[model samples]
Target: MSVASEILTALRSEEHDPVRLLRSASNLLGDEIAVMSSFGAESALLLAFVAEAAPDMRVLFLETGKHFPETLAYRSELARFLGLTNVQDIKPYLAQVKDRDPTGELWAFDPDACCQLRKVEPLDAATLSFPVLVTGRKRGQASTRAALPVVEEKPDGQVRLNPLASWSADEITDEMKRRGLPPHPLVSKGYPSIGCAPCTRPVGENQDARSGRWAGLSKTECGIHTAS
Candidate 1:
């Protein structure tokens, strides 16, 4: 089998263990692999894993400009900690933002539009430079992602790799501790899941892990990684 085929085969064979799956995928791709991280909750652990597993791998951190200050700081610190040499700070068009909302308040009245311009557009632009993108998504995180596959084809035919597709919340937390990694600063403050500041909130007691995102809305998946 071709090397790519082998990587896909091995990734598909597992459904619940993110660390082993990701480590295998990283070895198969090596310098060709790139991980997409927000440096949010659970992200530090994944990054640390990558650093040790494949120190030469590149990391893509999309800077939506509207991210929480903590997220931005964490991204920088993680890169320094990991000694990632080829980290890329992908970002949206600043000219477009200034043209539409000079004050950058677009996220207030029109969050979806803001996300498209700041998060989605920037990420799409960055994705074209790589053939594979690894993510930290897991099936148990929400209703929409319950059927997540370890290997899938993006609508654009770009290879979508989800190494953590089957991990449970407890398992992830345990792994983080096992690896001696720290959680995102906002995690303990009730932000079980996070995104743009305007849409994310503290999760309630009975809420699922993703409830903090777009709290009142029925929305779940961020458009950047969606197949549709």
Candidate 2:
């Protein structure tokens, strides 16, 4: 097996132990490992594990200028609250944005292209030197992610560590409470799944957590997770 595939197989052995999964990444990749956090609802749960596993692990936050004020504030608040010192905000290049989305309306016509411009491109650039990316995605969040594995081998060979892939929403909520972690400000307002402000909305309690992310559109993922 390739290095990525071997790592994925090894990580699959402990899908239920997020801390161990994170520690494995820390032990194996050290500084080459980084995490991608949305700082949305349920974020505090995974972040708590990251804190326990590797307090200094680099956490990448896509500062996709379109985020809600609350999300941005939550990003800062949660990172401080968790004692995570390596959180970095990745932003799109000014020239690219000026040329492709100068009017800031790319999300109105083609969210996929907009995501590529604002999120995917920036993350690709930021993570160039890193080989593994830890994520907070869980299977219960949405249908698209229902089959997400604990570790994934991307098309480009970077491994994605999803320590919470098997965790339920209730499990996350309970863990947050158990750890005394604060919820994202928007969660109380009903945004169970939060993303960029323009694309995210509040969903009914019965709906999938991610139903609010791209409401009327068929788009589910923002492109970063699935992109090569």
Candidate 3:
């Protein structure tokens, strides 16, 4: 079997233990792993795990330059609060942005292409050296993510390690509160799932956590998680 399959099979036994799962991956991958975080509502929980298991593990954040001022500030605050020393901001190439999104109106016309220019390409470059990537995505976040697994290899050969894959929204919130983790300021205003400012909005209490993201559009993911 491949390395990805072996890790998945090994992680199956520790599915319920997020911390241990994180540690196991860290032990196995060592410096070859990094975490991708949006620093959204429930991000603190996963960040806490990173701080515990491997404080120096690189955390990649897509600095799409379209985020709300609050999100940018919260990103810095949360990283400092968690003592995450290596939170790196991945930004798109200026020439690419200028050529593809001159007026920055690509999001209005084609969000998929916009995401590819901004998020996907930058992340692909940022994570090229790392064989494994850790994410905070959970199964309960959205319909598209309902079948998410703790460990899975993407078609691009990147192994995504979702330690919180089985965690529910409530469980995430509860744990964050218990740990006294600071929340993303927008969460209180109903923005449960925060992303780029243009694409994210506030949702109702009954809506799925990710409903606010790319609201009213058929688009669910930003094309980062999907294979290229």
Candidate 4:
């Protein structure tokens, strides 16, 4: 079996344990693995696991120029709190940004294109050398992800690991509470899902956690996760 398949097989038994999965992946992939984070709601849970298992693991955060000031601040605060030493902010190319979105209002007319420019391109470029990618996506977050797998192999042979794929919202909340993890400040304000400022909003108590993201539009993801 290939290394990816072996990794998957080994992780099957401990799929529910994020820290164990992270440690195993770190051991297997070493410098070829990196974690992609948004530093949004519930992000602390995954970062905590990274801190415990691989404190120096490369953590890539898409620093879209449109993120809320609160999110930028929270990213710094959470990194400090978890003692994550390798968190890097991935930003889009300045030439592309100026050529495509000079006014910074592309999100108003075409959010998908904006996301492609700011998130997808930057992440694709940043992760080109990494063979394994880790994310905190969960099945319970949205209907589109209801069947998310713990391990997925992209067409290009890159392995995407979702250690928290099977975790429920309650499980996440309980674990975070038990660990005293600090939440994204916007979560208490009803923004259970936080993204770029212009395309995100607060949802009702009964709404899906991700419903506030790209509200009124069909776009659910920021293209970084969906592309490739």
Judging by lDDT against the true structure, name the best candidate. 4
Between prediction 2 and prediction 4, the one with superior TM-score is 4
Clashing pairs in 3: none
User: 124-175 in candidate 4: lDDT tens per residue?
Assistant: 9999888889998999999999989888777777778898888988999999
Clashes of 1: 0
Q: After superposition, how far is residue 113 of candidate 4 from its true place, in Å?
A: 0.7
Q: Each candidate: RMSD to true structure?
A: 2.7, 1.7, 1.7, 1.6
Q: For residues 139-188, what per-residue lDDT tens digits would candidate 3 score against the true structure?
A: 89898988998887777677788999988888888989999999889989
lDDT of 3 at 86: 91
lDDT of 2 by residue, 1-228 (tens): 134566667677866789998888788777989999988888898899999999999999999899999989889988898899899999999999999999999999999999999999999899888878899998898888888988787777778889888889988888899889999888889999889988988999699888998899999998888777
Best by TM-score: 4
Which pairs of residues clash in candidate 2, taking residues 3 or more apart in a chain or in different chains? none
lDDT of 1 by residue, 90-204 (tens): 8888788788768888877776777788888888777765667888787888888899887776655566677767777888899888877767889889887878787789988
Model 4 is weakest, by summed lDDT over 10 consecutive residues, at: 1-10
**How high is each candidate's TM-score?**
0.88, 0.94, 0.94, 0.96
Better of 1 and 2 by TM-score: 2
